[model samples]
Target: MHPVEDHGAPGSGGSRSAAGWLVLLALAGLAAFLLARPILTGPVAGLPAVAQSSSPYTVHRPAGGVRGGGIVNVDTELGYRGTLAAGTGIILDRDGLVLTNNHVIQGATALKATDTRTGRTFPAHVVGYDRSNDVAVIRLSGAKGAGLRPAAFGDSGKVSEGDAVTAKGNAGGKGGAPKIAQGRVTALEQTVIARDDSDGSSERLSGLIETDAAIRPGDSGGPLFNASGEVVGMDTAASAGFKMAKKGKGRGFAIPINRALGIAEQIRQGHGGAKIHIGRTAMLGVQVRPVDAGRTGSGGQSADGGQSGGQGGGQGGGAEVASTLPDTPADRLDVPTGAVITALDGEPVDSPNTLTDLLLRHHPGDRVALTYRMPGGQPVTQQITLASGPPQ
Candidate 1:
């Protein structure tokens, strides 16, 4: 998964359409999805599939430098084949508080944040996340020697269609430098039903700013700046073409900076409790990977109810448990690794995203039933309470 943006299995080359604007988690390189050279084949299951180009983009060289002091490049490790999700963030406070999209940091085992101005990287900690709004905040844990420059805020409400603006981010998940693209705001108050390709989870985001500014995968959570260089929006999703491997052509939407910062403030204040997970996130306490190819259990049926991956042959299938967190729900139930999660709470589990998407549908302490089959065994159903923790 691009972790936060798209939820396709790693290295998947598939595309789905939505409302004339195909939605993807603005992740790069399904084969490399934003960052990390490929070590395997297949889409990033659990992350959504966005458009990708067989060719590298024409790298744009910013004349002066990365303009804003607050703009930070975000890199996340999604725990699969050294895969990563690359995006951008805006510094909200001099205390090192940074604002980004929830998907950008989702499922990250570790986060490395690099400030464009300081030219330095720092380990960051998740402050809080509002998955409903797709916004999140993190703090640069140990960047004392590096100066923190918060980006100047603009009133998104004051923004008008046709206004000229510039977008910036780690386009292509290419490292070291960030790329910039210029265009005009095309619309306002747009709504996109963005979905995770892997788990089939969707969120209806309203009151967004739409632009034709050439935003690309790996540009999610990046900044949309006005001519004054004031921050106005956070780039989120881009439209993908119908063909697999077709590149997105800059039709992108962003969460209004005002709304994003507002939600981020609540997270910092520790409000909304579990409804808005703070610091650590809620989890089901299980680690899983897609079941192997050509492997069949009882009745010669795959956990996904069919062959692993569809006819296109991507990494689509039910997840095989890899491990369980100690003292957590799965552990308490003695959920053994290698068991295939075929269903959860009666819903079919087609991919790892299915498990996560279903889990996100409930709150901490909520109980849900799981249907699984031990390696080479028959299916078994068990109920387990959910648990809360940081992204591992």
Candidate 2:
């Protein structure tokens, strides 16, 4: 009631109080802006890119070093644990198709894949396996099945030795994230043998990229990345006779990831145990019809399939000599039928395909000689000229 009469000046204490509040509010707004600047810049990177999925890899490391860890974990978005070993896997589909190694999940009774950051583990069911290639695809079920982080893949053939490389995979144990390794490739067109003694089976991996980057068993089934971080190969084995890679012994092997991808896709699409075409490669000119086992003879012993006209499994004798054809690369040299050439460039040649694969490494015009034994066991030397196909 007294305000009208008691007011000292027109806009005195009330105005001052209002101005103070305005200044405080303005300062508070600026403080708020500064606090949220980092968040406002963009979405935080540590979180998974896919809306609600857990990140596949971790951004932080223990401060020593990491090569492809971040890329594998962040990009592949899946990790696996199994009997052969624990490794990383790629999510090939939005519905949770994981591509891993046959050896990784081979003969495993149970499997559990978890996002290292989420503590959420998904039970993975083995969909199918290809023993020929040592590759497998896994399907995740239940809550962790959706919102997967799929990696980008590329043509592996385009990658060449000496190109910069990155690898993503699980290292250590279940707590591990996709670790990184980087180096120039040491070799290509690699051939490594994997033997399953338990089943008396042997398999070979060819067309592989061998690198000096150090990797471990846990790295099997992981992805080998290019500079762009796109997966180019599937991390598989160490170099031939390379049991383990330690410091200063940089060496690792990766299968062309493209092949694994193709197989995995087919398995996901409902073709189980499907034989992959891998594109048949021809090596020699002589095309021997599958000679019947009982009808033909090789090393004087035969099987139901056939004589295996090439080298029979037993004791190594010579480089392979197929049934001769008229005017072909072999016939051009007058290679006598039943002449078994044992070695090429000082190594025992086992299969005709391997020899052909080796020959392809040389130019069509290159000169290749043979060391073989004729029917009488007399050694014969023939300097043979190479050609594209079975010489006419």
Best by TM-score: 1
lDDT (Cα atoms) of all candidates against the true structure:
0.62, 0.47
The candidate scoring highest on lDDT is 1
Q: State the lDDT of candidate 2 residue by residue for 33-124, as single tens digits.
A: 11110011111223221111121222111122122322222112111110112455666654656677665553233555654434456777
TM-score of candidate 1 to 2 decimals: 0.64
TM-score of 2: 0.48
Q: What's each prediction's TM-score?
A: 0.64, 0.48
Reference-based lDDT, residue 84, model 2: 19
